[model samples]
Target: MASFHHCIKSGKKGTAANHAAYIARQGKYGQREDLISTGHGNMPAWASDNPALFWKAGDKHERANGAVYREHEIALPAELTHEQRKELVDDLIPAMVGDKPYQYAVHAPRSALEGKTNAHLHVMFSDRMHDGIERSPEQMFSRYNAKHPERGGCRKDSGGKNRLALRDEVIQTRKTCAELQNAALEKAGQTARVDHRTLKEQGIDRTPERHLGPVRIQAMSEDEKASVVEARRDHLHRRAM
Candidate 1:
């Protein structure tokens, strides 16, 4: 099954360029040597901004000057080829970010040692937009607009009546991803399909397994490995009972 992960990070003064460089894999911090390809969008001004200048742009209160960026790491089904995976990601990007500037990288899994290879996409996007005449952060993340309280801003919901939340968007994105993957699988005449719903929601009684990090598992001693295996077996046995 495919997995989903999303995260957001705030960029303080002097860090916007660094974050951009890291995502674009341009500067010394470009550590994703395993990437197959990298792509970017809507960041011409950010790309050219010097560190000092970028820092100055956010010279208001430290809080006001900081920018928030989002990162999403999505697991690509092994059933899809590299090109197909890239195409899927490309289609999803615009839908997610709209007019905001963003960067992404596609990574192929390292040679599998103990399990199936994992391919994934890493996406990073800024929270600001340029409307030809002006550039500003999305209203969803901005301070409350008292004049247009009904429109809300970042902190309040549309109409400023409630708190703005991203739960709905996150859930919808997961479902959309699952639908996209299922469509591809159907086109390929594959039997596998991904589900965005939780096991309980799908009426499945089995307990989900904990994710043991690959590096930690690989470094376990013989006794430690046996203990871990036994724990899993015991859990399954108890569940059966």
Candidate 2:
């Protein structure tokens, strides 16, 4: 139901590090900005939130990051939302974590169907009670690492047969949401915010795979792709040399 991936991105152009640049555009190192929009070479927002929570370097961090991404593919029903998301998450996480501890946050996508399902949870927590003496950042990070070993191991089947299943699930979720909302919309006699069928029509969520079987590989002409050796041989023979 969940997976994680962790990468140590820094303030770099064309990468997520750029996010810090936008937030810290005018300010000195410690000052805050007015309207922060993520930009190139920007400070890591997660770090800004809590310096102790900077991304660790390792495989486990990557998997927890992946678990967060997987939750998006699972697609929360629209009835579930920012407020409700946390409440349910609180309940569901216990099953995931037992009495051990961890910090977790949901990374809601801007749009669930954008293939941009990357908006995800950011959780850095420890199941081990810190003695405050022997524990290292590596030990803290390993708390999640030890708990979730499957991170970044496999991306959700955004390809092949599983791709089709994902499509169907997303579409159905939107439809169910639409039907319920519009029913409530009628109860209030108000206009609808969306058209679920329009989504299906537009191939946004849960549409069937185009399902074109066995892509026929067009053969390149032997004449067109002739190797240098073959071309030279042909040329020499043709010249009667």
Candidate 3:
């Protein structure tokens, strides 16, 4: 499961809007590489101010252990003019899920990624809202937690216990984008239309609150490779789906 969170920047917008900005970045970029100039917020202005502080402020909220001691952000979409997209994302995420429901950060592609101009945002939030009632996000996370997520939706009616709702929410957003894009194309009288389902299948167009489990090792011998790969995929799918 991919994570989604409310990104924030104090003073620019209200708290909730500030918090959810990053997801919009990734949403625009979809799948690509090297989106962030620094690990922090994609501020070219801040880059000159202080390189060290930028990463610290934008340090990887997740991935504190394993191989990465320091946080690194992945690609965000370039389709957004940075300023325009950040504002759009910040407002939308909080407006949808409410702020502080989860941890958030913007992810841009690392330089190693190829042909990627997109800088996307990634977030990890509870499926619960701060609205004092179980929300759609809670319900979606609940389903995943029921089978996985380690603890089963925090084991409380305080939040939802279903997973489909959250997945659908992300999927729907992609759909909305597709529809808008299609309309724009039609307005221009162009034959091109976006195949929106691709995002659903690829999982980028959707938001995932839970952590995707482990991946299997590669480079095994042919005799062992097939079984190992199959097992790995099955395990991940069981948890992720």
Candidate 4:
């Protein structure tokens, strides 16, 4: 099954540019030139504005710096060839970014010894718009309120009272991503698909296995292995009850 991971990175200490540069492989001595790709949607001309500037503008607040950018890592179906994977990602980008300024890069999988060779896409986007107008911290990051002192607010909730919370937005985004991925797989005649729901939500009753890192597992003593097995057995027994 395809794997889905999403996270938000804060630009609190003015490191947004660094993060953008890293993802875009802009600096010298960057690795794997063929592995890097970038795109932007609903954004100003690439010559004028970039991901760093987009996120920096959103984090103008001296205090209470909100999430400057969000990111997603989605595993591409291995059944598809390189060209098909690129097409799938191209289709996904526009759907994911909507009107917000965004940037994405596709990373190639490592050698076979590195484990799963699942190619994935990394996307980063600003939560605010690019209206070319200066805004206060509260105005830029907070919910929309006409009566408030600041101007040009962000998105609002369904009731139109407070700003739409990030948590809700993330959940919706995950569901949308799963649907889009499944569609892409179907188009490619691939049977593998992804799930956005948690194990409980999917009615999975078994205890999920803990991820022991490769190095830790390799170095584990026999006693340690037995301890882990016993712990997992106990967990499964409790869940069964």
Candidate 5:
């Protein structure tokens, strides 16, 4: 099943250029590349052609305490073909990233579990929305000027929201992802579907499975993995009872 995960990174934690390079599997990440398609869009003219230049500028110019980018690490259905998954992602980009300069890549890696594929997409985007005004790299990350918009930095979408509003935004994005995935599955004539809701919300009584991330799963011994599988089977049996 597909899963939704989102996070925002500040300049103090990491630079936007490094994150971009990681997603695109450039530089140091080249050895581990599982890239399918990578691209950038909705950027200022100066950095439109090359996303690296745009992100590098962001790293150099943004304030130390400021958020550099927001990332949505979304799992895609392995049942769908690569092209089908790409189509679904294409539809999603406009909705999630509208008018924001963003970079993204799709990757298909072998799953930790046997006979499965782990296909996913990562989108790294600026919270600042693109306006018509043209600003140099230095001015792009500066404080926004309300009265004279052109002289200021781009307007940010991540700020000014209360905790409740931010929570709602995350829930909405999950719902959107679920909807798109279900539609794609239907189009592909696959019966499998994904849910955005919690188990309680869906009236499921079983204990939710813990997420053992890819690295953890890969590190486990075969015996340990078998034990995990057996445990999950027992859990499911109990749920059925």
Candidate 6:
């Protein structure tokens, strides 16, 4: 079934390096490195080809308590081909990220639920917009200098957004992701469609199912996994009615 799942997360300093390695399927996450397709854009000159270097620098140089990255985890429809999925993400990058430095990867792993293909995209980016400035790695993450722009760090666009604005941005991100997925499905002549609305918003009475993270699913015993599958089956049966 087509699914509409999109979530955003922010990480404090020192997280970007670990996350970049994980998304790139490096280190402990290297088991399925062959199944990963990664790309990066808007990088500064020093780390143009190697985004890991930029992330490592952020971990080392970004201010304490500063958010180093914002990540978007989006589930892609399994009906789309690998190329089609990449194209969908390609379209999203320019719209959402603009001049921000970003790294993204697409992974297709066997679904824990039904052993079918489960494809998804992970995009990690700095909210700091890339200005055409030349600064050392240390200065790049330093406090913004209002008086001398050349001496300051890049500006974080989301820094001053109020709570309502942040909430609206999240809503828009979810809506955009759903629209893109639906468009891709339609282009492929697929009948299955996904909605971004919650069950209550869609006038459905059933409670929404909780999402099990990959790490959590990996840790479950066979019996626990079976219980989850049974619960999912029950949930689907109820949703069908």
Compared with the true structure, what per-residue lDDT tens digits does model 5 show for residues 59-147?
77777777778877778886788789989899777777777889999887776854366778888888888778889988998888889
lDDT of 3 by residue, 1-241 (tens): 1112222222111222223333333344445344342222322233334333222333332122211111112222233456654654454444333443333455554322122333454543332222233323223223324455443322322235368875676566555545544454454444444444643575543453233222322333455555644653454455444
Go through the candidates in order and give the C-alpha RMSD of each one to the true structure. 6.3, 18.9, 15.1, 6.5, 3.0, 2.8
Give the residue spans of candidate 3 off by over 4 A.
1-76, 110-116, 131-170, 176-195, 199-241
- In Å, residue 232's CA in model 6 sits off its true spot by 5.8
| Residue pairs of candidate 6 with colliding backbone atoms | none
What tens digits encode model 6's per-residue C-alpha lDDT throughout 133-167? 98788888888887897988887888778999988
Question: How much lDDT does each candidate structure score?
Answer: 0.58, 0.33, 0.36, 0.62, 0.79, 0.83
Model 2 residue 31 CA deviation (Å) reads: 17
Model 5 clash pairs are none
RMSD of 2: 18.9
C-alpha positional error of residue 109 in candidate 1 after TM-score superposition, expressed in Å: 3.0
Candidates 1 and 3 compared: the better one by TM-score is 1
- For model 1, residues 14-125, the per-residue Cα lDDT tens digits are 4555565665566585675666787777653544333323223433322454554556666777778777777778777876677666677777756323345667777766
Model 4: how far residue 64 lies from native, Å? 5.0
Alpha-carbon error at 181 in model 5, in Å? 0.7
Candidate 2: what lDDT?
Answer: 0.33
Candidate 2 — worst ten consecutive residues by lDDT sum? 34-43
Model 6 — TM-score against the truth?
Answer: 0.88
lDDT of 5 at 226: 82
TM-score of every model versus the real structure: 0.66, 0.27, 0.33, 0.67, 0.87, 0.88
Best by lDDT: 6
